[model samples]
Target: MNVNKNLLNFLKSQPTSYFAGFNRGIEKEALRIHASGKLATSQHPKGLGSALTHDYITTDYAESLVEFITPVEQNAQTSIQQLLDLHKFAYQNQGEELLWPMSMPCFVGSEDDIEIAKYGTSNIGKMKTLYRQGLKNRYGSYMQAISGVHFNFSFPDSFWQAWASSQGKVANQSSIDEGYLAILRNLKRNLWLLAYLFGASPALCSSFLNGKSTPYPMQKIGKGTLYLPYATALRLSDLGYTNKAQAALNIRYNQLDDYIAGLRHAIRMPSADFASISAKPGDYQQLNQNVLQIENEYYSPVRPKRVTESGEKPTDALERAGIQYIELRALDIDPFNPAGMSVEQVRFLDLLITWCALTDSPDIEREDESIIAENLQQVILYGRKPDLLLEKNSKPIALTQWSTQILAELDDLAKIFDGDTQGVYHQALMAQQAKIENPDLTPSGKIMSHLLEHNLDNGSFGLQLAKQYRNESFERDFHHFTQTQLEQESKDSELRQQSIENADELDFDTFLTQYFGSSLSD
Candidate 1:
């Protein structure tokens, strides 16, 4: 429905080789749980490396929540293989702990039990933990405990050059920024489809409710398992990782300058909600009382990101260069997959991302913004519900009907990326189309079916998969990395952390001042 005819025509003429340089990476986070499925109390494994300076593995939100990052690669299979090898290494080093297979965490006891991630004694490291402290105080730790996957995708200079040429535009940083921003907008518009197809979190351990009430109608399966029969990714729902506070900021996404300015305002805007909860750095509850302590605190399903230099804020890096890649933060870790995602999923993402960038995207109007948001919320909470109607063009339409239309365009893209060969891209597209055709084939639907058939709670089901995947991971030999190589990297990381700690010239209070020095003071 949203196609830039000129660019689409241009891409059709160019050989598929022009798009061969597309790069990808994966960063997946999962909680470290014991065999009993309770959150692991152990610190991040010494064998995994320093959370502050490590290239691949790190901690997210909590000490038990481990994040695995794969270096950028051109081939989708290579990136997936790297992710698996990283998992294998982690299994080898993490002792008896198993990575929680689901995005939604269960059996996490009190908020006190969930320790904020420690990044060591470096000034920047302390700042990282304190920012999380702010998140804990503001949104609570349970929200932070939720785990998911981030797919980082970027196109090459040649691909962008071709697009700019077709549009009579120069392929400069500004154009590159616009290209990525367009993908961001369109991705948001279609992200619900992702939640519908790949969302595996249909149910969660009732412990996740924390005895709180939920707006969505839910049913109990086992004694403590709560679920919505039609739900997709509850992690995308309000009860999970919703960004209720950031809604007020109204961050603009149409242009880079406006996006940066919006972030600038949020970082500086004093929040009374946070002010009441926080103490100073020496006895700190949070880094500051601002709306966002740092740009990374702001959440979006899709974000145009740059790899920042040391000590540079994300906005500073963006302003200095341009968007390096777009990170898709919408994915829920598939419980069935050993590595949390499959090659087919990423290949489909390649097709979708390219289509989004090439599609004509205008500035989102206020009403359009609401429609896009509604689509996501509806899909996450009630996607598999038969005859579900989603708002589109300010009117109600069947979810499947719209999905079918989108898939048609994606099929065309698969052909473009695959040429005459029967390739993985087309296969990925077909796989998703099957999900659209058969609701039961969707990850969430399958999860629900297994829960019903086996009479298992979310915790029991998750533990089963976690154990199975752990066994499979151990059996999977490393192709990209070795035990010795990973051990050496971890040791080297410790040295790097020490150097950073030794280089600290100022106390954390002064460090915070300089870090926020460029922002407008409230």
Candidate 2:
């Protein structure tokens, strides 16, 4: 059977089910905050596996920020179960610590309050910590402390072969790369809608500013919270990952080879702004003085990704084979869900991503990034303002109008996905439509309302949920994994770390020299 024949049926004349055999996973991060809502200063819990070698569990920029990664599952429900179970097990093992329930950290007094995650004595482990050290030195520790969820999805090989056949292309690396790159381009074009709908970090602890000055017209709320009247995800605003340093890189997304070349150039290019920092001091503050230490440092809402083997760089992996999947990094932590994302949210993403893959996408020119950045920042800053104007082909259009048009196209996709099930995709689309119609129903709006209605600041509100979720985690029994299995995995990970450390003979400096001088960086 021609599997891809009906993949685009939403836009074609026929009606057929789509998105079968889709593989999806989630990587969620949360700070291990103390009971009073202050970020925990403790090290990564020993019960959770080694942060360096663990496949399913790790830490992010801070030792207190634990990251849970779920294995790819065939459906959303199965994946959700795995995430929920992992959270439950972690809570059972940890003594008094609680996970922060939102994307933005709360009650941070100073940069010194957060601790950088330590990997081990091995060269690879030291490199991981050094990369994070570079992040801390370059961009303040306050920004690195903030975390977000990453959704990874990939179409099965069968779908790709069928899709290639339909497009009259060979089902090879070039064709697969072409298909995923189109998806990446379309995803960047429509990311504003995702922020508008699921953006929950509308407010944050005023202390997050670290006594630094900001240019936004932020007003103070109850007990030291800072927020705008109509902001969505402040996490994506200039206050967060959207920095001006890489704005001039002008990375384009038209071809796979071009994309790899751009990343390689970025790693090799020097930056005057960061040159003052130590490239290789006695303490070794950063990996290098390049614009980017490695390709992973370039932040984007979406990335065309391929899994790499031992010692391979991200770009090298794609250049070697092709894009295995595309990771979407725009989703904020859903404060309401214990897993930071809901099954319905996953279904909506499936529909939207597949829609993007099937739709035609134009190449992103050198100048297009600025336009895209402008639109995304507008939404991040004041997305909920009534009748907000956004750029469409360099002309102004109402955000509501643009959103409605996107939703209308998504409606057809919903129907196609709902052909067999109980119309869950259709239900998800309707829920999103309601958010477009009534901005107050959106996640950001709901969160903001709760804070104002209760006269509570961001920290207080986040703590309330944190306590509630911790109780739920303890009350519910494990369903997906046994306690014995998790503990054994943890012990096994420690053994692996010890083996890696014992095997290294050369000093860290010699190891780093060969790493950069190797063909991987070139």
Candidate 2 wrongly placed segments (more than 4 Å): 1-7, 10-18, 420-422, 518-522
Instruction: Give the per-residue lDDT of model 2 (tens digit) for 1-522.
Output: 012444464235434433557999899998998898898898888888798887778998898888999888877887887888888877876778888989888789899888999999999999999999999999989998888999999987877876677688898878888989988998898888899999999998988897778899898889899988899999998788666777778776789999888888998888897888887747688999889998889987899998899878898898888899999999999998888899989989988888787777789886777788788889998899999999988899999999988878778767767764448888888889899999999989998888889888988988999999999988887777777887888888989999999999989988888877753355
For each of the candidates, give the backbone clash count: 0, 0
Top TM-score: which candidate number?
A: 1
Query: Which pairs of residues have clashing backbones in candidate 1?
Result: none
Error of 1 at 84 (Å): 0.9
lDDT of 1 by residue, 38-98 (tens): 9998999988989888889999999999999999888777888888888888898889999
Query: What's the lDDT for all of these models?
Result: 0.88, 0.85
- The lDDT of model 1 is 0.88
Q: Name the weakest run of 10 consecutive residues (lDDT summed) in model 2.
A: 1-10
TM-score of 1: 0.98
Error of 1 at 133 (Å): 1.4
Relative to the unseen true structure, what is the C-alpha lDDT of residue 310 in candidate 2, on a scale of 0 to 100? 82
Give RMSD to native, each candidate: 1.3, 2.7
